[model samples]
Target chain A: MDKRREVAVLSELDKKLINLLQHGLPVCERPFAQVAEQVDSTEDEVIAHLVDLKERKVLSRFGPMFDAVYLGGAFTLAALAVPEEDFAKVTEQVNSFEQIAHNYRRTHYYNMWFVIGTESVEEIEQVVQGIEEKTGLEVLNVPKLKEFFVGLYLPV
Target chain B: MSENNNIALTSLEREYIIATQKGLPLVAKPYHAVAEQLNISVEQVLSMTKDLQERGIIRRVAAVPNHYKLGYQYNGMTVWDISDEHAEKFGQMVGNLPFVSHCYLRPRFLPKWNYNLFAMVHGKTPEEMHQLRSQIKELLKDVLVERNDDSSQNIPTQSNDMLTSTEILKKTGLRLKDKTA
Candidate 1:
């Protein structure tokens, strides 16, 4: 986790670009130019700052935020409480599946938490069953009953 | 819309998703770059993307910054067991908080697990994370349940807890398998 941390000191321009672009970029031929106009900067300068941010690992992604569920897919948050000795092996078995989109090691009794993304809603159950069989662990499959909000706007 | 809704993706749409899933090119004409790759007209690419967004497929065309790199080093997946009757009301209130990035009401597995409300919060330090957690607790104080003292009960002893991530085992964003391969 420490190795992945590259704390970049963001400049005023970088912060402005991030805070503005996060809401969304216009879906036009020259969106950057529009953003530049809003920020009182040039299109090339905005592009250069964004490129630098991406390279510095500050920007994880810069594109369309697709909704997997809307795209005829399903996603569920699942957890497994693997034994200490089998942690490494269990992580490998669980992650081998392409369906596992994001996996995290959390501080909890049921430590190994991951999100399963499948092409269809019904396949979510199948993936859960597969992971349980492969790891010999009980999976706590928790799908969202109601989504209150999901807009991620972190002001830098 | 039902979660089971099967909105079939056209072959071109699938190709477009595959082409731009990594990210759009940083150029004067980003859509044109994707159009060139798929051998489709620039107008077609732009129109398809707009259609997808209008259909609620694409949430937004945006830049997602790494929170940790931006000094938000501490992130806690705060879970709570709130009254089902007032869950929706309280969920909305908690979700409206600026610091709360994601808030959802999920099912609980009784006996072992009991948290039905999950809200992810981030902070620059552990102290800040705790403060945010406290703010959430204060917001849902009325709806939050107090665990029964009876040892024989099949419910968890605690009503809420924050599970901070220790490591990112895998961080690959969603990927669609190339069926043609």
Candidate 2:
């Protein structure tokens, strides 16, 4: 953890920017412009800061938060226990899909866990099967049996 | 809104949501910033965001935790060997608890493992965490607490990615030391 990157050391303006990005992108045609206006800066400045933020790695990828159910996209959370030797190859294959958003190699029996957001349940299952068949690993379909309130709130 | 409604998302929408999950725009018109990036009107952003929230597509958009910094010193990932018949009942009941932040069911790795229900709890210290666990125990005494067999290791990779990292997990506390790993 870069002490410098610690959110506390940031300037109020930057803090506000972090807070803004934390909640979401401003909903406006000229969002940066709108944010610029709010922070009393130019739209260009807001965009620049975001780019810098990404460079710093504080902000991961910047874009959209999809609602799979709404847009009719079928998505699922799946995992596979890839042998340590095969981890790299399996990951390369899994990440190959545009549907794989976030993948994590965690410590569990079923290790290389990933999320796939696609267009339909059948399609999602088919993709899962393909990954398993190709990787020669069991892909566990741990779909959310029940939707629970998943809120990541860290009081700033 | 029948909270169960799953509205599939557009590629553009998915991109924006992933980006913003870190945190929403703090600007007075945060939605406007999003609209600008998407090359759409602020009004459209606001309307869609509202729809997402209403549809439970995007859960509450808010600030995430720096657990260690916040003094939530202990975290525990508790699993239950719940029978399939009552798994949903147990999961939903446990999920609704204020302290029980996250609850979910995963396919059990049988022969070797059979715990199906998993939950994550966070507290200021080991004692606090233990106390919370006891409370959970009293509530779930009927359900058998699965023996934790996995060695400690995992987190921060996910913790490092705050927004999209909000899934209910199974590690907490001194385990947080392993978090940075």
Candidate 3:
């Protein structure tokens, strides 16, 4: 946390770039230039700021956000309650599977939660079953029945 | 259109998605770079991307900030056990909240799990999140109270729990099949 406080402060230009980019980058040949025009910066400067931001670890990713479901794949949020002593062991076993996309240890009974992404809908179960067999823990598979909102944009 | 619609994607669109999934190059002409890779014109790449956005295949082409680094360290996965009859409408209302990044109605595993409505809230601290949670509780109070009054069998009308992430055990980007053969 202390390290984050000292990395770099966002300048007005950086702030404008983040604010504009969060909404989206134009889908054109010179998208950065388009963005620069909107942000009062040159194409070269916008690209430089973005590169600097990425290098500083401010932006995790910069690109088109693809819908996994639309790409003919299946995804789900699953959880497992692992014992304190076996947490490390369980993590190793669970992460061994490539299908596990994002795993988080939360403060709850069902502590170990992860998003599983598979090539097809049927494979979702197969991957969950494999994890159970390997980890010896019951997986509480909770797929989203309905999604109300998803996009997140924080102004800088 | 619904996200689950059976919209057939052309091969070119598939190629574009696979190529740009990792991201576009941070250059003066990012789409031009993508076009060169796919052996297509820059205009074609741009139009295809626009088409994908219109079709809801691509949510947006944007910069995803590292929330933790951006001072939004406290994130709670708030789950609620709202009645099935009103979950849809209630979920929509909850989703419209500014702090709620993701709102969903998911299946509940009985006996162990009873939560169906999940809304993920992002904040700088637990106190900030507590404030947001109270807002949600306030919004759902009337509905819950009405549910309890309506039926004696379904005693606990609505209940919620917040799960804060302690550690990121594993994280990987969703990868697509390579079709540049």
| Model 1, span B140-173: residue lDDT tens | 8888888766588633468899999888888777
Which has the better TM-score: candidate 1, or candidate 2? 1
- Binned by DockQ into CAPRI classes (incorrect, acceptable, medium, high), candidate 1 is medium
Candidate ordering by TM-score (highest first) = 1, 3, 2
Runs of candidate 1 with Cα error greater than 4 angstroms are B1-4, B38-41, B149-156
User: Each predicted complex: what DockQ?
Assistant: 0.68, 0.14, 0.58
Model 3 Cα interface RMS deviation (Å)? 2.8
TM-score of each: 0.91, 0.56, 0.90
- Candidate 3 is graded, for docking, as medium
Instruction: Report the interface RMSD that candidate 1 achieves against the true structure, in angstroms.
Output: 1.9
Per-residue lDDT, model 3, residue B36, is 87
**Candidate 3, what DockQ?**
0.58
Stretches of model 2 off by over 4 angstroms after superposition: A1-67, B1-28, B32-52, B63-78, B84-86, B97-102, B106-113, B120-139, B145-181
What does the lDDT come to for candidate 1? 0.86
i-RMSD per candidate, Å: 1.9, 9.2, 2.8
lDDT of each candidate versus the true structure: 0.86, 0.57, 0.82
Q: Is the docking of candidate 2 incorrect, acceptable, medium or high quality?
A: incorrect
